[model samples]
Target: MALLFWAVGVLAYLVAVFHRQSLSVAGLDAAERMGVSEAGMATLAMLQLLVYALMQVPVGVLLDRFGSKRLLLTGALTMAAGQLVFALSDNLLYGIAARMLIGLGDAMTFISVVRLVNLAFPPHRNPLLLQLTGLIGQLGAIASTVPMIASLHTYGWAPTFYGAAGVGVVMAVLLIAVLRDKPSGQAAEPGLKAAWTHPGTRLGMWTHVATQCSAAAFLLLWGYPFLVEGQGLAPQTAGVLLATLTAVGMVCGPVLGYLAGRYPLRRSWLVLGVIGSTAAAWTAVLAWPGHAPLWLLVVLVVVLAANGPGSMIGFDYARTFNPAGRIGAATGIVNGGGFLASMSVIALIAIGLEVFDDYRLAFLLQYPVWLLGVVQVLRYRAKARRLLAQLDEGLGEVRGAQEPALGTKALD
Candidate 1:
């Protein structure tokens, strides 16, 4: 049953992920057809992300109250409806509404899966399981790239989106049929009061949401532009490159999970800081007009790969401290925070590019933001370590007392 649930979670993630990437492709096409400015397109992206981020907390709460299966069904249906609107629309307002729906519908899959994995697996196995699941979802991103561009080329964006909408309905049906809220014999309602009341968990959740939000913003401002314009890669090449970024992430996910498992959070962040800094610097160098040599694009692709895992480590850190029963809500909070940060940054950058008329400089400026986030993560890690040490000492004292009691009972 656990394995079955895991499979369902993977499928749910795939469906949500497919919709997420499809939008980027469709949005790019829409902008091209409408003669929209870079800033305008980014503004549209801002809408999509803002709605998505804003919905995370509420969605998390819903998942906790209503259960994963029901929420998953809702997400699937909502996404399909959003795509239908997107397929039919010709203007930005319609596009905005469609993207908003996509964001809302997209909310349920990833966070819910994290909760499901937490429930289905043991504590020690969770980090790896999440990393594994991330890999599966990356495949969805991959599909969006070359495969999506090919579809868009062959049938046009409208048809592709409509087809995706049909797929969404199928996914909704599957969720309604098979997914379950809790495993048998572990049945107990996960109450809203208890889930919402934990201060540490709530803080941890917001921390995650902020971090991921920032990462998303950074990726859009710097990474997406570099691929679309700076490199002057065709849409198909850009899509393939996009796919490569996530595909490499699939590798980084498990490797980082192993590192988190082996070392403490602070140590892991220090290493990530170094790697992410290198990635940022290298990406900047590659993105610099005529500065990047022949191999620069390849190097940038590798760096782009690190972005996904960089955020995942923060998420792993959050999960470590979360209360067992509140894991779903906690995951939602963390995810929401990260995405919210991303939306804010994307909106700001979109505004900046219009004013400055130079995207490369605007994009380079965003790199420092990630470095700053890394510092925050390091600080959080140090604080977590101190707290954990205190917890260990307290647990040791309890164990020491219990050991003597057990020995005395043996003598009797």
Candidate 2:
């Protein structure tokens, strides 16, 4: 059962990631065909990400209320419609709308897959499993660059999208047949209210961590390109570098997960992650333009690779606080916050650059974002430790109080 679930999750993600990278490439082709400007094309790309971020909350809710199977099917259909729209639509507006649909569908795939893996695997194995998932997803990205370019040249963007949509449908069907709502003997109909209303759930899912994480992720995705573009590198080189980042992250993810499991101290790891990420960002700044040496490129790759650890830490944080049977919502909230932040980062950077075309300035502005994330994670760690101490003391009192009740019940 675990193997079956794992396979489904991997294959589905492979298709989704491939489709995602394919769209960006296709968008360029389509944009050229339509004579859209670079800025206009950028806006279209941002729109898809923004919509994806916006849908995270609702997608998470649907996954929580209904099982992943139904939502997966719905997402797949919506995604297919979006692709069909993109492939066939004549106007930019239609393309935008199609991208929106794709975002909606694509957003559902990540959290759903995470939740499904969480359900399928044992607790200790979750991080490694997620890393493996991340690795597979990276292939989708890796394909996007040279590989996708090659595929596009041979097949054209239209056939490529059509083929992707076909794969999405097949994945949806497999999801329907293989996926389960919950493990056997677990609650068949767990109330959403009961599962989601706890203090931990409310705080972790709704506030603090989710938003910060979202912002950081968004910064990485949208901000990185702008940073490179600002440095005067060709889009192809930037894209290659971006792909390298994901590739390293994919390889490092499992290793980090393994270390995280060994340490079992989330706070220390988060501190280290913050340090590494900060260093990486600064390294990126230093390596800008002609300064980008081979050694620095390797450094960027390793630093960018730290995203794996950062993500694992985020997942660990979510799992600790998420109420049982509510992993989907928790996963959604966590990812949603990151995506929302991403939307904001992309927008804010665009605005900043308009005034002062300085990529370094934008990069400098983003350091505080990573620092903020580190601080928040640290605060969470401190508060969690305190709460656990309180709980332990409270348990002691309860046990003391319970002995008398037990004796009385025995007498009765």
Candidate 3:
């Protein structure tokens, strides 16, 4: 029964991710249909991410208030409404609104799923389960790349989007039927004030920012256009490459999850390694004289894909440090890190594209952010470890006190 309910939450998360990435996979159809420029199309994506980033705290608060089941139900229904609007609208304003709705709904799903994982699973299993959530959620991204494009070509705009909306509604219904907010009785409302003060929560946030910003920015908006328009790849080929990002992510998620699980104390090292590799990969691409080789791009995407799971390290931080009641809030703060970073990078990339007229140079703008995130992750990681150590010592002292006196003589 526990497994069944948890599966529902994960499945709902998968669907939410599918909706989130839907616009990316629309091929050229989105712009052509809406008669929007690249920047205009980017507006659709940027605003969506902007909304998703902005909503984290509020959504976190709401989840704590209402519990996971209601939020899951509401999130699904909201995404359904967004997709329906997306299907029917042809103009920019409505398209923007639709994407915002999707963003709002998307924001509600992942953290809620993480919260459910905490409620339903054993403590030791969390890192693995969290990684597994990221792994499976990426399947949604893969679908958006291949099957989504297929649907767009076959059925055309309204039908494809309507089909997506239909899935959202079905997902919502499933959540309504299956989701359990707690193990037994009601859960406590988290103190937002307390959640904000925890060093672990901040560590989680910076970890997310360090690891995810680049990958999120690339996959969510810029990568497709950079391939098709900038690097001059065929859309068909670009779609395949984009799909590969998710594929690599699915592969890497388990590995990272296992590693994080095995050496929970060293989770930050895993994140830093992934982040370093990501920076190196992007550096190679940006410094290439002409268009990067296909193999090189492939390698870069693989590294970028790892960050998706790498970013999950943030939630692991939050989950480890936070009390169960505050999980939602902590998760929200951690989750927001990447998207906010992403939003900033996307804007800078847009500017670079306009001013420099080179994709490589435009992408170079991310380097400073990489530096910033790395420093902060190191700082907070140290703090989190210290705090965790202090906590363990305190608990150990209490346990020692609770132990029976050795004998009156020994006790004396």
Q: CA lDDT of each candidate?
A: 0.64, 0.58, 0.79
Q: Tell me the tens digit of each residue's lDDT in model 2 across 1-412.
A: 8878777777677766665555544545676766775445556667777777777767766666565666667777778778777767666788778778878888878777777776776655666677788778777766755566566678876776676677677878888888666523333235445434433333343233322332233223443354345455555665666667667767676676666555443334544554556456565755576556655655655566565445545555456554446666556555665666555555555555556676555545555555665565455445545555555312111111211111111100
TM-score of each prediction: 0.83, 0.78, 0.90
Cα lDDT tens digits for candidate 1, 1-412:
8888888878888888888767565556777765677677776677777777777767766666677787778888998999898888787788778888888888877877887887777765676777788888777776766777788889987898899899899998888778777533332236335544433344344344333443355334345465666556666666666676778778877776566455442434434553465546556663566635535666666665665665665465355445556555556666776776677667666766777766565555555555665565555545544555555411111111212211111100
Backbone collision count in every prediction? Answer: 10, 4, 0
- Per-prediction RMSD in angstroms? 6.4, 7.3, 5.7
Stretches of model 3 off by over 4 angstroms after superposition: 182-190, 385-412
Candidate 3: pairs in clash? none
**Candidate closest to the true structure, highest lDDT:** 3
Tens-place lDDT per residue, model 3, 338-402, is 79888888888878877888888898999988899988877775665576555542211111122
TM-score of 3: 0.90
Better of 2 and 3 by lDDT: 3
